[model samples]
Each structure stands twice: as C-alpha cells, then as structure tokens.
Target: MSPFEKFLKQLENVKVIEPTISYDNYVTIDLSDKNPDLNKELLADAEKFEIYIEDYLQKNNALVAFGGYNEVRNLYKRSTIFNGEDFDERNIHIGLDLWTKEGTEVTAALNGNVHSFNFNNSLGDYGPTIILEHLFEEEKFYTLYGHLSLESISNLQIGDEFKKGEKLGTLGNAEVNGGYSPHLHFQIIKNLDQNSGDYPGVCSKNKLDYYLENCPDPNLLLKIN
Candidate 1:
C-alpha cells in the first residue's frame, strides 16, 4: 500500500470530531450528480437549501449530515469564481463536508500546529479557513478546516498548537460563511504545495486524478460511518 494509505489505516483509532454525537447520529449526504434532488434551482436559494439539509437530518434522526469527497456538485455553478472564464469550472468537491447547525463547535482532527489562517470572503468561498501542519510517523501532511466563524481565527497565530479533540472554532452561518448553509469543510492534504491559509477545496474533472491523490477521503480519519 502507498504510505498515505497506510497512514489512513492508522487513523482508524483516531477521533477527529467530538464523540458527543454518536456515529449513529451521523448520516451521509449526497449532493452529487447521482442525487436527483440536488439541482440548480434547489441549491440556488440558500435558505431553501439549508431547509432541505435540516429536513434530511431530521428525517434520519441525525445530528450531523456528512459526505461529499470527490462529489461533482451543481451548487457552484452560480459563482463565476468557481465557474468563471478563468479556466474550467471547479465543481468537484475534494473535501468532506459536515452539515450541522450554525454555531456548532468544531474540533481539531489531530495534534498539529497552526500553519496559516485567513478569511476568504468571496461568494461561494470557504469563508474563514485554517490550515494546520501535522507530522505522522515522520511524514508531514496538512489538515484544512473551512467555513468557520471569524472568531475562530481572530486570535489565533501561526504556530499555535492544538491537540486532537481540542475545540478550534464554531461553524459559521451563511452571512459569514460565504453564503451557504452552515457546514465544516474538512480535508486531509498530503502536501500544501506552498499554499497558505487557503487551498482549492474543489477541482475540475480534468484534474481529478491529481487532486484525488493529494486529498484523500477524510473519512479515513473521521470514521463517521
């Protein structure tokens, strides 16, 4: 197996998010092309989309709705920044999204030092984002936490340390979280490639192979299911 794959296997014993919400309370959500319920019109209205997600969680008796690794979503089509003339559209989600209510507490997935943090305030962006640098078995990697409240990084400095399960921040609302239903975008990046506080959470179909390799499924660590 590849070294990264082996590293993922070791994460089975790790608890990324808090265990207060049991595994059974976490439900998988699909916003990909396979889910017929997710269309341009449905995702266009932020309120309606939020309601849709809440309703789904309520129906499933779940507290958290999570999934979306390598999912090609129609949600970004409205943002020219994502689907602009600059290049091919970047709609394939490279991270795992945990959909929960706004203000829900988020914790660090592993022991790491703060690498960089910033607020990407553009429409359909990550909003307040934080990247942490971690070392496992002598190999270096990165973990990104996005869609966070401004207060999360307000007092944080580069090199600040956080242990696993440490409360890092709270989920931000649409107003502060780049205009979307509240959710935490978590990603495990093999390499930052010189990226700082921000990194592309989504990629185009043409570059799927490279991104898929660089950003592995975070479920490898969360084990939410």
Candidate 2:
C-alpha cells in the first residue's frame, strides 16, 4: 500500500453513506465481465440495470451493494464516452461504487472542505459531482463523490467544511446520474493534477497502472471489505 493508503487504513469512523446503515447491511458485488448474472443487455438500459440491482439487493438481504475498484467491466460499452474515438476502452473501474436507493445520504469520509463541485452533464458521466480536500498527518489528499443529486451542488460554495460522516449530498437518480442505477462513485485521489470536481473513475488497459497507483482502492478507508 502507498503511504497515503496506509494512513487511510489507520483512520477511524469512516462511513460514506447514511450513518444509520450498519456495516453488516453492506454487501460486496461483482460487476466485472466474469459475473455471469450481469450482461450487456442489463447494463445497456438504466431502468433495467436499476431493477437488476434492486433484485440483487433484495436477494442478498443487503441495503447497499458495493465493490468494483480496479475491476474490468463491460458496463461502459454502451456509452460512447469510454468508447468513442478511443478504442482502448476505459472499462476498468478505478473507484469503489456504493449502490443504493436514490436520494440516499452521502457523507464525507473525513473532516474536509469542498474542493470543487460540478454538474458533469453528459451521457454516462458523473452528473452532479463533488470533490473534497482532506488533510491528515500533515498530508493532503482528495475524495470524490460522483453521481449525486442536482440539489447536492445547488447550495455549495468552494471551501465549505464538512465533518466526518456529515451529509455532503444525496445520491442522484438515473435521470441526472449519467443514466445508471443510483449509486455513489466514491474514489480516493492522491493528486488532482489540476482537475476539478471530476476525475476518471474508469481507465483503459494501457493506463491502468498509473490510475491504480494515483487512485488507490477506496475500500482501504471505507473498510467495507
């Protein structure tokens, strides 16, 4: 693990969703190509995908389905954002996803201030997104909350402070959350590289090594494993 990742692991009381839901209610899900139950057909349509996720959650008796950091998935094939003009295909998910109901509360992983937030409106994009700047052990890092409700960013200003587990925003629905099932795309970014409010949550094979290093598995902090 990188030094930042190690520090994250040592931190305490990290929860990104509704604090009422305990850890036991969270289940790990596999959305990679290897998961036979998930297919192109299901991923191609937002409503279908939401239905599938609902069924999976019901079957597993879990409120949240989380996973997909560094997992190669076929879910992006339907979106030209990852495929257009770039045959390399950014299908390798670099962020851990927490799938749950629309409008579910999303909180900060640590005490931090809003770094940047934007409405990345595009097909298969991180619709209302927010990035928080956090400092610990005298080291600075960032946390991104993507696929958020439009209201999430409506009243935000730069440098707004939020305590750990405090409500940063709520999850967005398919209509505004890039046409996917309502979920929080939570990622830990070591460096923003001048980017604001958004970063690549998926990567291509050629750039996987770099992205994997710069964006470590968020589960290291969430400890949802």
Candidate 3:
C-alpha cells in the first residue's frame, strides 16, 4: 500500500470525537473558490465585513463553531459570490474540527515526530499550529493541528517524538486564535513539501482537485461521526 493508505489503515476505528454532536445552527459562509479578482469595490467590502465580524465576535464572546473539515457541509451548495462572480462550491470539508469552549485539551493523534510548528495569527488564519509525522508500514505521512494555544509550540522541538494521546496543547482564546471560537483544525497530509507548522487548510476551487488528492479527507483515519 501507499504511504497514505498505510496511515489510514493504522487509524482504523480511532474515535476522533468522543461524543457525536450535530452541526446545525452554525453560521455558515464560504470563501470564493474563484481566484477572487479582488477589485477595489470587492476588496473594500470584504475588508469592512471582516472588521465588523471581528469586532462583533469580540464583544459577543461568540465562537466559530465548525471549521476546517466537516462531513455535513453541503458540497452541492452554491459557491459564494465575491464582488460579482459566482464560484464553485468546494465546501465539502475533509478535515475534522473540534468546536467547543476554548482551552480544550488537544491530544496527539498518534506516535510521531514533531514535523513542524508555527504561530499563524491573522484574520481567518490558524493562530498556533503543530504538525506531527507518522510512519506506518515503512510509509510516512503527517497530521496538522491548527488554532492551538500559543504555549503549544513554545518549547516544541522539530523532529522530537510525541506518543499518541499525549498532551499536545490546549486551544487558544479568540483574540489570539484568529478571532473565532476555540477549536482544533486537524488535517492529514500525504506530503509535507518542507512546510513547517502550516498547510493549506482551505483551497480555491481551481485547485480543489490537487488539494483533494494531496490532502485526502482526514476522516478516513479519524472515522468520527
């Protein structure tokens, strides 16, 4: 079997979410799969909306419920409109997300080396990130944990090994965790491409095919309903 296939086989029957939960009542929006020309009018409007949402969340203490990969996402839904163009709906999320109160304990999914780590703090960006590499059946792959607490990567050393179920870190609060609810964006990557603590959690419609192949749905390993 290929590296990716081997990794998936190793994770058979692993419980990604301890308790299953419904994903209803979540405010949903999509980024344009189209390149988003970002003309002056569209760029300005997007910026304003982004700022408004940021402030609103700060004042309301509301969290972003579900992100990264969601099996329930209606892949057939219409693509979002940016400026004037309609893009394809590449919204069938492949990663698994843990949307709950902040400070949730994030455990290592499996025994692996610290492949990479970084602090990505931007609007709609992963606040803090860690990627672990797993070798199974002589094949190698990686798992990425995003939107984690700052301390998560404080003392992490690249290539250091962590066992499955080890305390990888905790979830960060809104101000530091990309101004959203505290949750983990966990993704399985077949190839690293030398990226450290970062991978493309979101992909444009044009590149959906490539991203889908390179980054398969993590549920294949997690199998959490």
Candidate 4:
C-alpha cells in the first residue's frame, strides 16, 4: 500500500465530524452520470437541488450525505468559469462533499493550524474557504474546508490552532456558498504548492492523474463508510 493509505489506516479510530452524527447517519450520494436520476433542470435550481438532497436524507434517516471523490459530474456546466475554454473543462470532483443543512457546525478532523483562507466569490465556486496544515508520522499534509459561511472566517488568522473534533466553521447556503446547495467540500491535499485558501477541488480528464495523486480520498480519514 502507498504511504498515504497506511497513514489513513492508522487513523481508523479518529472521528472527523461531530460525534453526535454517527456513521450510520451518513448516506452516500452520487452526483455522477452513474446516477440517472439527476437531470439538467433538477441541478440548475439551487433550491430544488437542496430539496432533493434533503428528501434523500429524510428517507434514509440520515443526518448528513457524503460522496464525490474523483467522480465526473455535470453540475459545473452552468458556470462559464468551469465550462469556458480558458483551459480544459473541470467537472471531475476531487473532494468529498458532506451535504447538510446551512449553519450546521463543521469540525476539524485532526489537530492542525490554520494555513490560509479566502473568499472565492464567483459563480459555482467555494464562497468562504479555509485550509489547515497538519503533520503526522513525520509527514506533512493539508486539509481544506470549502463552502463555509462568511462568519466562519471573519476572525480567523493564518495561524489559529484547532484541536481534533473542534469547531472550525459552519455550512453556508447558496447565497454565500457560491450558489450551490449547502455542503462542506472536504479534501486532503499532499501539496498545495503556492496556492492559499483555495486549491483545485475539481479537474479535467487530462489532469485527473495528478489530482488523484495530490488529493487522496477524504473518506480515508473520516472512515464514515
């Protein structure tokens, strides 16, 4: 196994989100083409899309929904920033999205220091984002929390410390979270390079290999499944 895989195996007992929300309360969601239920109209309207998610959670008696790591999706086609020819179209999600209600508290998966954060105010983007630097077993890595409310980063500094399972922020709605359903886009990045506050959570097919390597599956840490 890869070093990262071994690292994740070591964290099998760690709790990432709030303890009240158990693994049984977490449901897997598919936004990829494999889910034939999703269509253009359903995904176009933020409110409707959110309702769809809520219905799913209610049916399954789940408190939160999660999935979408390296899955190709059509949800980004609405934004020119993603669909435009500036570069290749970026529709494959490299992050795991935890879908829950707005204002829901988000917590640190492990002890880490605030690395950087910023508001990426653009259509179909992460509104308020934060990145934390972590060191484990002599290896360095980073964690990113995206789609957060503005208040989450209002008083945050570059070096703020957070213990494992400590409150980090709250989920933001479509109005403040780049016009998408309220969700936390969590990713584990091996290299941030010079990027701050934000890194590519999605990539094109051509760059899939690089992203799949840099950003490992967050479930490796969460172990929700």
Candidate 5:
C-alpha cells in the first residue's frame, strides 16, 4: 500500500471538525485588509477562546481528521504582516489546516518515535512543536505537529515512543501559539533532511518542487473530502 493508504488505515477512530471555523472568526483585529505590524494585537486570548471551541467539538464529536498549526495572513502575498518581510512563493502554505479551538487534543497520525520537540516562541512561529518519525513498510517519513501548548513539551524526551492516534498535546492559544488563529498545521514529510522540531510549513514558488516532493498533501492521508 502507498503512504497515504497506510495513514488512512490508521485513522479509524480519530475525531475531527466539519466545516472548519471561518478565517474571519479566527483573529481579533482582523488584519485581512489592513497593513498592520507583525506584533499587532489581531488575536484574543487563546485560553479563553478555546472554551467555546471545546464546547463546539463536544456537540459535534466527529471523526478526528488531522491537526497542526495554521495562519491566515495570506502567505501567497510574498510579503507578510511581520516586519514587512518579503518572501518568495515558497512562503505560501503547502499543508492542510484543521480549524478548532485552543486546547484541542492532538493525536499522532501513526505509531512513531519522538524525533524532537521545541518551543519555537517567535513572532508568528510555532509556540511549541513536536515532530515524529515513523517507519512503515520500510519507508520512513516524519509528521510535524505545530502550535502546541508549553506543557506539551514540559516532560517530553528525545526519541520517546508514541503509538498511533495517541494523544500528543493540546492546541495553544494565539499568545502562545505564534500569534495567529487557532488551527493545526499538519504536514507529511517524506524526507526530514536535517530539520528538527520545526520544518518549512511555508515555501516559495521557486522551492515548490522540493517541498512538494518531500511533503505531500496531508489530505492524501487524512482522506477527508
């Protein structure tokens, strides 16, 4: 079976959200049309906002599809709200985002060893992130789960073992999760190269081929139409 098929077979009991929350409901200041500074207060308290998200999930206990960090800054602009930083097309997103509340449970896509974990607490960076290494059918690949709460890595160890669909950590708020809307940025990486807790979630147009080859569409494994 292919990598996507293998991952689908393992997501039998995963919980997810349908009709992900809209981008408008994600931020506080609504920078969709404004040219604000990177540090502008466009988002609210993650902890407080997550309460509603949690309640919504309980009412709509659907299949857990996928989870990771997300941003609504329209990465394709080649320039971000962050310090007027200009980037190439590679800066655009190439991953799937699972929209939900803060503190949402993040589970592993498959059984794997803890490759590395870190607190990437920078402006617009993944607050706390985790990467897993999986070996299936002699094919090795990595899963990157970003924007996690600090406690997620509080007691984590390098090379730790985790089972498929096991709880890894809770989603973090905008303050702690790199100042953006609450969502998971999930990606399937075929080659890790030398990356650690963080990998390129966004890439430029020039580097699209490299990213596409190394990181396939997460939906292939999620199988969520």
Candidate 6:
C-alpha cells in the first residue's frame, strides 16, 4: 500500500456520522450498476432513490446505509456537472457515502481544521461542503464532508478546529443537497491542489486510477464494514 493508504489504514476508531450509531447499526449499500436490485427507474428521481434506501435499511435492520467508494453509479447521468464541456461522462463515485436521515449529526473522522467550505448550489452538486486539513506524523492530508446542511457552515470559518468525532455538520435534504437523499459524502484527500471547499467526488474512467490513489477507500478509517 502507498504511504497515504498505510496512514489511513493504521488509523483507528474513526466515525464521521452520529457517534452514538455503532458500526453494527451501519450496513453496506450498493448503488453500482452491478447491483441487480438497482435500476435507472429508481435512480431518476431523489424521492424514488430515497425510498429505495429506506427499504434497504429497514430490511437490514440498520440506521445507516453506506457505501459507494470507487463505485460507478447511474445517477450522475442526470447532472451535467459530471459531464464537463468535453462530455467525459463522469460516473464513478470516489468518496464513501453514508445514507441517513436529514439533520443527523455529522462529525469529524479525526482532529482537523477547516480548510475550506462552500455551498455548491447546483443540481447534482454538494449543497454545503466542508474540507478539513489534517496532519498525521508529518503526513498531511484532508478530509471532505459534502451534502451538509446550510447551517453547518453558517458560522464556520476557514481554520476552525475540530477534534475527532466532533460535530462538524448535519446531513442535508434533497432540496439543498444537490437534489438527492440525505447523506454525507466523506472522503480523504491526500493531495489537494488549488481546489478548496470543493473537489471532484466523482471522476471519469480515464482518471479513475489517479483518483483511486489520491482518494483511497475511506472505509480504511471508518471501518464501517
């Protein structure tokens, strides 16, 4: 494994959601094209997609349905933001998504300071996002929290400090969170260039290798499964 990957894997007891919710209450979810239970019919609208999630969680006897790291999804086809001017068709999700109810408390996976935050008020975009800067034994990295409530960043400043598992924000609803089910798009970024507040959570096929390396599986820290 790469050094960053090693650093992430060695970290222990990281939780980005409600601290009270144990990993046992967290169930893995598959929104990829390979999941036979998923289809374009249910993915066209946020309401349908949410119902699908609620059903899955209910079936699994869980509170949170999380997955989607390095997962290719069909939902991005509805948004032009994924398809840049060149029409590269970005569909692979690079961040780990935790699906749950709106207003659910979201926390930091580790001690960090706010690197940036923004309200990317576009369809299929992260409504309210916060990026935290962290350093582990001289290995600097970042953690991004997307699909957050507007109130999350209302008083947040660029360099705000937060300890591990501290309340960083809450999950947003479909109206504000890029018109999707309420969930937290949590990611670990090793090298952030000039981008702040926002980074590409999904990538095109050509850039998949780079993203997968830069943004490794966040489950390494969360250990949800």
lDDT per residue (tens digit) for residues 54-140 in model 4: 999999899899999989999999888788757899999999999989999888888999999999989899999999999967778
Of the two candidates 4 and 5, the one with more favorable TM-score, higher being better, is 4
Per-residue CA lDDT of model 3 for 1-225, tens digit only, reads 555655576665443222223233233333223424323343334334345444444554544333345332322232232112465444445566656556767778788899889888765567898999987567688888888889988998999888777788888876776655566788888777878778867655576667777777765676543
Q: What is the C-alpha lDDT of each candidate?
A: 0.89, 0.92, 0.63, 0.89, 0.64, 0.91
What TM-score does structure 1 among the candidates reach? Answer: 0.96
TM-score to native of every candidate shown: 0.96, 0.97, 0.66, 0.96, 0.69, 0.96
Judge candidate 5 at residue 190 and give its lDDT. 84
TM for candidate 2 is 0.97
Better of 1 and 5 by lDDT: 1
Query: Compared with the true structure, what per-residue lDDT tens digits does model 5 show for residues 29-101?
Result: 2222233532322234444434444454455663232332222444234224232436443345656766566
On lDDT, the stronger of 5 and 6 is 6
Over 1-225, each residue of candidate 6 has an lDDT whose tens digit, in order, gives 877777788889889999999888989888898888777777768999889888889999999999999899988888889876876999999999999999999999999999999999899999999999999778679999999999999999999999998999899999999999999999989899899899999999999999998998999988777
lDDT of 1: 0.89
**Order of quality (lDDT):** 2, 6, 4, 1, 5, 3
Compute the lDDT of residue 121 as modeled in candidate 2.
Answer: 87
List where candidate 5 sits over 4 angstroms from the true fold: 1-90
- Pick the lDDT winner: 2
Count of backbone collisions in candidate 5: 17
Rank candidates by TM-score, best first.
2, 6, 4, 1, 5, 3
Q: Could you report the Cα RMSD, in angstroms, for every candidate shown?
A: 1.3, 1.1, 7.9, 1.2, 6.9, 1.2
Model 3 pairs in collision: 64-181, 69-95
Candidate 4, poorest ten consecutive residues by summed lDDT: 9-18
